[model samples]
Target: MKILYILCLLISTQVFSQDDSFAKEYFKNGDYEKALFEYKKLYAQSSSNINYISQIITTHQQLEQYAEAETFITELIQRVDYPSFLVELGYNYQLKKDMAQANLSYRKALASIDENPNNVFAVARSFQNHTLLNEAIIAYEKAMVLKPDYNFNLQLAQLYGEQGNIEKMFISYIDFAEANPLSLGNIKRAINDFISEKSENENNVIFRKIILKKLQQEPNLLWNELLSWLFIQQKDFKKAFAQEKAIFNRQPESLLRIEELAAIASNENELDIAKEIYIFITQTAQDANTLLEAHYNLMQLETKQSSKENYQAIDATYQELFKKFGTFSQTLKLQIAYAHFLAFYKNDTKKATSFLEKTLELPLSELQKAEVKLELGDILVLQEKFNDALIYYTQIQRNLKNSTISQEARYKVAKASYYKGDFKWAESQLKILKSSTSQLIANDALDLKLLITDNKYEDSLQTALKLYAKADLLSFQNRNDESIALLSKILNEHKTEPIIPQALFKQAQLYEDKIQFDKAEANYEAIIANYRDGILVDDAYFKLAELYENKLNQPEKAKALYEKIIFDHADSIYFVDARKKYRALRGDAIN
Candidate 1:
């Protein structure tokens, strides 16, 4: 008997759900009379269902039965003490063009909030639902004032923003952020809509003044952090550095934020400020790891700005660091960087090779060892020891299978094969790597695969492709002049080949490396004019746009090119960056 009872109950509940769904569907389809009939039936069965009651009222309003809706709401208010029904009655009056009655009903809802502050939630939400912004604001504020423990700053902030009250919105958001610190990221993202890259933007100025005034009233590290962030946004790294220093002075436990700011500055080409920040880190950091990172970054900055004459001094500084902090696993990155510097910068492969091999004797994780081996493989390839380099790369592949480093090692393996003119093997390797978890590696693999497949059959001997690969190898070895000349030969001799665009792009990069911006511009223009459908066209567009913006002082040209990427190549990897540059150049008020 109990089993039969359970089955009956299940069937009844399923019928109930189906009936409710049918009623909602009818309402959604604008079959109001049927919806009203179904809703009334459900309400008859479940008299306490608020959803049914609300839907009945809304359906009546939708059918232009405002008088009926108001009567039903008034009846509900008298039967139940639910204050939100007053809002419904007011909305019905509004639909009927009865402004006086609407105001009276809305005032009754606000008075309900005064009687019980907890009623503010439903009251304000109802007001917002009806697009009554002013009433919603009053409801929230009154409740918060009456009940000190109630907090509705987030809601108030949104309402103020909608009302174009920027100052009040900022204050409310900041107050909410102060109360709930973890929401800082969310608040900043919301605020990002109002500010621009220019520090002098009106909204930016307003926000800065607000933060400054708050800082004066109560000096908090959060304000300094925010100021630093704003300065970084404006590309004013010098001021950002000062703010970061103030933060570090007050809370010297970690240099992580300062380190991040320095990295941002470096990426933005603010090398002097980056160097200064790193130097501060080196001087003030108490931990060996922090000091080492600072020294390493400082050396990198020096290397970037240094000429051949500064190599000897840079080498001495490396030795000084080694003497201070002994060679160990902790200093592995510095050691690897030093090896790259020696091999690539100084062209001392023998010494660089020996140094890395010695460093390999230290205790390290497999991933760490893979990092060292990756660099060592590069040095070996630099020395033209292709087979030896393959051994190390294959070991990493075997040990750390499917990891990003493993994928990197596999890419190196394919690169090594390509450099050695083994097109078939390189293509095979690249084919497998097209699905690499890392987008960068996958893109690179696809590009190389396309390069080989496109040109391998162009000549019976594959002469042009081989020469192109050799040029690529030379570029990897930092022999930019040779690579440029070889690529020029490809352009001159293989003008009709599909490889022309790729060759031109490669040569343009090499020219840029040589500081020959005009030549680079010419090559990029060649690709854009002749090979609009080529895979490298978007790349050419972005590179040329960057050159125009930074090196050539042709902001108008840059803006035009960025506009192309924004509209034409939406799927290009450079789309986001292009859009950002486009907006910045256009002096957009918001990002």
Candidate 2:
């Protein structure tokens, strides 16, 4: 008798499982009638299973049988005494457009939360689903008050942001961060939603005031860090430097964060503030390595902004670094920088090559030697010595197989081959590099590969491609005027070819580099108007938008162009940045 009973129980379980699967399949396929029938069978087998009961009600609602859904939910509430059923009942009434009954049911749901604080999440979620956000907020607040351990500040902040209540959002997030200091990273990420483009904007002002007030009341170090972050985002490097100094003063371990801020300032073109920050680091850094790097970076910034007349003084700065650091492997980067400066600015490739070759004799790792060789190869390329440059690049590729440096060397080889008019060899090398580990190298490889493959087939002798290659080499050599003229020839002669757009875009870039904004704008506009369906359309749009926003101060036009990328070119690489710019221009703080 016992064995027969166990077999019957197993058989019954198998039958129920099959029916549950059938119910889910019908629900997924939107066969609500069949779903309801199956769910009813499941409910009869296990009347206490809330899953089956809920599915029965939901299927009825999905089928627009609201009266049936209400009847079922009412019976379930009576049987189970569950508070969440009140919310489900309210949802059904909302679907029926019975606002009075919906409000009553929703109130009952909230009142039930007072009796059982654990029901807060479900009640709030239901209210949120019905778009009754105020009630949801109340439910969350009530839970927090009743149970001090309850923390739903994240949800509250998001809801407050949705309502555009910036102050409340900031307060909630700040409170949450203070309570759970380990979650400061998440809090900062959340606060970024309310940061405006302009630091002086209302939201920024409110945030700054709040942090400042918090500092007065309680000097939490996290406030200082957050303030520093906010200043960096606003590009206020001076203020950020001061805050970072405060942090270092309190901790006194390293100047790493300050060095990073200096780099950020330099990148944003705030050269003066960047120089000041780096100078401070050079003077105050306790470590020799940090001091050396600071000096090197400071001189690099000066070199970039220096004129021909200023090169001698910059040269003196380089000599001072060499004197201080000596010709060691640690000074390899400085040595290479000096080599480039000499080769390009001072126009002395012989000295540059001779100096780099000397530095290669230093006690160095294989990677360090490859670094020096790479720069030397670049200098050789600058001198149009393709064969000599190829020798160096090939050495690196052979020495460091499948590494990032190897991929870089391979790209240089392809570029040098292209420059030397060996299009076939260049195309072959580029094909391998199309999957390079380095994104910059891979992108460059693909661009050069397309430039060759697209134009090589047009002329067997590769006349236009050779000219374009020479133009590209000239541009690399900083002979901008000649590059522009050569590109112009391509445009005028190859008017009906695919290379015209490429030429136009290249020349536009050259014009922008020379600060001739009007000509650059015209060229970009021509590409957009002519090559609407071309691969370069999105590129042209983004470039033109940047020119208008930065050079011409026409934010409206820039916004429209950015919107085009957001709406049309969603697959373009520039979509994320374009959307950010668009939101900034529209004065939306949530970007």
Q: Which candidate is the best by lDDT?
A: 1
lDDT of 2: 0.88
Kindly list the per-residue Cα lDDT of model 1 for residues 429-496, writing each as its tens digit: 89999999999999899989999999999898888898999999898888888998899999999999
Clashes of 2: 0
User: What does candidate 1 score on TM?
Assistant: 0.89
Candidate 2 lDDT, tens digit per residue, 30-117?
A: 9999999999988889665556766888899999999999998898777655667798898899899998998899899999878988
Go through the candidates in order and give each one's C-alpha lDDT: 0.89, 0.88
lDDT of 1: 0.89
Off by over 4 Å in 2: 1-31, 42-52, 96-101, 589-591
Q: Model 2 Cα displacement at 336 (Å)?
A: 1.0
Where is the poorest 10-residue window by lDDT in model 2?
Answer: 1-10
TM-score of each: 0.89, 0.91
Clashing pairs in 2: none
Residue 570 lDDT, candidate 2, scale 0-100: 100
Separate clash counts for every candidate: 0, 0
Clash-forming residue pairs, model 1? none
